[model samples]
Target: MVVNTGKTFDPQRMLGTMRLADVDRGTDASGNHLIRIAGKPVRWALGCNFDVWPWACPATASSDAVRFGGDIAQLTDPTDTSIGMYVGTNAYYNGIFFEEQPDGSHALTTDIAAPHYYADGSTVITGSIRFRVSYDLMRTDMGIPNPETLTSTSLAGAVKTPTGAPAAGKFVTWHDPDGGGFFIEASGFTFSRKRLLVDAARITPTRPALARTVRKTARRGVLVHTRALPRGARVTSYAAYCRSASGHVVRASGAPGSSVVVVTGLRRGRSYRLQGGRELQGRPRCVERAAHPARPSLTLRPRAVPAARPAPASRGRPRGWRSTPHGRCATPTPCGWRTRSRDSRMVLNDSSA
Candidate 1:
């Protein structure tokens, strides 16, 4: 008789009280049949734990065989255990997978090629990306206005005046024929009128007259030549005035011709004019004698009186005697001289006579 083994496996209850060590034995509940062992249980489980939904599935497989699901596939290396599958949103796809190894740790399955849908992660969260952005701002309404255009016709014509002078501070603008505009400092008068008015009002300087003509004459009198009229012709008059060097006019009427005009009484080196213009110009020459005709010749002789002389010695004194207690002269006197008391007079004796 053949027994039918058609029991459905429940993943949650199948390995209920079984330790990992017991799972090493490939035993069904009946324990009557032995299952094939492809490799070590731990290594097998670790290898099959990798993500591989596209690879393998078995029909009528028990829960123990497919409990990990058709999504897992066997890793060629027993070192892989854990599994990873892509569940990305939008356009992203898995670039790498993680797997658990026999050591109970996870690692990337570097052998598998990445999916075609996989892409490099975006640096920004926004879906759209641009390399750069540029913006420019320009002022449209604000700018400097053009300078006001000026014309020659805008200026006033030249000002005109009828009678009085133009009022102070009155102003008028005049245009240059060349199109330059300017304001006049004055107003109410024509250009020529203003010039003529100024000329009439301005002060005029007067020309100086000739100085009085001076003439000299000689009249009869005792003319004394002096510094007052030192080198000029001598003159006299009934009513005459002497001019001092200080510009003083001293009058002397009815003075004698012999009267000496002392130039010393006047200042030195000054000019004066004599009276009687041309009327006394040709009078007879006056004759006068010098007051001291011998004065000039006397100056040539040496002065008779000695300028100074030493006092004589006392009576009965020897020719060279001195009255000093040592009987010697304190200082020598010149020849023909002597020394005496302070109050004694000096006498010049003509010994040869």
Candidate 2:
């Protein structure tokens, strides 16, 4: 993590570099035009420093400066070495989070405690290390506050697919509850629906229980199902199987426990799966939720909109013009998405009024 003490760093003392996204408060949803509110600031716009390196202030540093450029091999004390880093990645972010405090300012916070491990063999902490970075559109002090020490824990685990086959090829990565369990992302931002996990096709290759589609359809919609889950538990990967009325089979599956599956490309029927489960994050673990026999089946169907009725021919007026309630002309043109009133002339919009 990077911190600036409202001071400037000698450019010659900077060693490496760092990067961060611009700070954004929000936007005015309604206005004559889209007006960016608060606005985003450079990572170190208020002060400077990245990681352990010193930073130059805006007055002396380049425009909207962020990182520092100093030599690490040589230090002021001739004992310590290295400097400059404004970002940290050891702690897997559960999701991009931002919040507003009682003071009317926004705070970006998370609960991932990552221990500091140095490759230079200089430092090792078996205890917990917490991280916190605050942002304020009004604050003039060092924008990013330093991280603090807090209650912490050590995390590690292992996951094996099966004796005969394997689920994924990548390393058995253990993502903190925020890092997404091994392969599946259980926590963070979950939309109403999920990507297609069950494969929709005539032939089922991976497993025999998974059904296949008999026919295909044009448009597709999502099918959703929800069940009670423990706090912090999320759906990582899932499989879906579907069948037609005549016993024809169709299937869909993606990335592990995808909540939603594409049931299109097949005739109007239903996709049925005997069982499915979500992969929960935390320590390396194998999901047994979708492999049970007593589990309930899920069904998804797409709702298609009927075609629109044809508009009647113009009432004896110009080909492109139509009579408006006022003594004005109207045309069906897909241009702007707003309507406003001038001094004497007003635009007739079917959407607004």
Instruction: For each of the candidates, give the backbone clash count.
Output: 7, 38
**Quality of model 1 by C-alpha lDDT:** 0.22
Cα displacement (angstroms), candidate 1, residue 11, comes to 99
Please give the CA lDDT of all the candidate structures. Answer: 0.22, 0.27
Identify the runs in model 1 with alpha carbons over 4 angstroms from their true place. 1-237, 244-246, 253-264, 276-353
lDDT of 1 by residue, 214-246 (tens): 111111122232211211112232333345345
Residue 259 in model 2: lDDT: 32
Error of 1 at 209 (Å): 30
lDDT of 2 by residue, 1-353 (tens): 22231222221122122212211111233322121111122222222233321212122222223333312222354222111111222222232233443433233332222222223223331211112122121111111111111012111111212132222211111222322111111122111111111100111112213332211232233444343232222334445555544675655554434334454434432333334434433212323434445554544332222222223564554333333556433455332222222322222222222
Per-residue error for 4 in candidate 1, Å, reads: 99
Judge candidate 1 at residue 322 and give its lDDT. 32
Name the Cα RMSD for model 2.
24.1
